[model samples]
Target: MIPPGPKAEKLAEEARTRMLNEVDERRDPHTNATVGQLLDRYMKTLDVGRSTHGMYAKYLEKHVRPFVGRLKAGALDGETLDSLYAELRRCRIHCTDRRGVDHRTPRPDECDERCRSHVCMGLSSTTIRHIHFILRGVYEKGVRWRWVARNPVFDVDAPRAAKPDPRPPTAAEAVRIVDAAWEDPDWACSYGSR
Candidate 1:
């Protein structure tokens, strides 16, 4: 019988090691699976529009991944989620705004002030409610996959979002507004004599 060459032996060994590693990873109870993994699974199951998937991926990468990427799939809990929310609020305030030209770094203290007094402080209740919804969905998937026994999000109460004041314009109001605009000389000039 011919002896196996070193190259052949190395290939065989690599194949065997890869197979074993895959099995081991699958069985590893404490293996870290980040929000990215959950997001992929969610995208597969969700019947939402592509826009929603894009939005969720953006939020997962920007807000969720940095804090929870190293945490084991089973290690997330209510307290951990709460802490993550706090961190997100803090980060939003301190986040660099490069809206205009000449990307200057705003003062660190100014950033903190903006975060605490405005950005963090003024976060709409609707935004907080949406965060709660995302967390609930993520943890629910964890439960479904047997990574978690129960959703931590189920145990917490999110603040109620303020209802938008319903202001459907009446037919008369609409007509009045339209008529006023049509009669205005400035409006006619701006709208090309329409």
Candidate 2:
């Protein structure tokens, strides 16, 4: 007793899709797995050096775990991943030095303190990209296991790497370097001869 029209067709489609998803979830062993659980399992199987393993653990706990740990694996999507990267780009942390001392203020002459932590502490693009890499690996595993339909990280735009400082050598400096090379007899015998 249903009227056939565009509205009815749309309703029928939605019902069919919902039922399909429900069935899929029922069959999926990881449908109930949280993001944190997935990451924990993935991390366990990952092979890395002692230092690198520590670094990965730190980043996972600080960034990804805080935001998406509780989210169901199947619920994740591209837009969700996009916002996570955007959050990482503008992330700020308390500027600190190797000794764990706060150095919030920078030297008046220096432009910025990326390597040295100060009040303007923030994660670099390289660091953000690294974090993304770890997540991508875990999500790909999820896809292969049929825990999720797709990897959301694939839909996200890549992080923008910071440009390196351009320091072209002066012509005078270049000439002095060449003059020094010619002055050395040992250099001429081994390298300059070729």
For TM-score, the strongest prediction is: 2
TM-score of each: 0.54, 0.66
Candidate 2 per-residue C-alpha lDDT over 115-162 given as tens digits, one digit per residue, 9 for 90 to 100: 442333467888988988888899889888777767878877668877
Alpha-carbon lDDT, every model: 0.66, 0.76
Candidate 2, number of clashes: 2
Reference-based lDDT, residue 83, model 1: 76
Note each model's CA RMSD in angstroms: 15.2, 7.1
For model 2 the local lDDT of residue 157 reads 68
Please write out the lDDT profile of model 1 over residues 74-171, one tens digit for every residue: 67777887777766555554355433222235543334332422233434566656767876897787767755555777766775769889998899
Model 1 has an lDDT value of 0.66
**Regions of model 1 farther than 4 Å from truth:** 1-32, 93-123, 163-194
Stretches off by above 4 angstroms in model 2 are 1-30, 48-52, 94-118, 164-166, 182-185
Each candidate's number of clashing pairs is: 1, 2
Once all C-alphas are superposed, what RMSD does model 1 give against the true structure?
15.2
| TM-score between candidate 2 and the true structure | 0.66
Q: Give the per-residue Cα lDDT of candidate 1 at 49.
A: 81
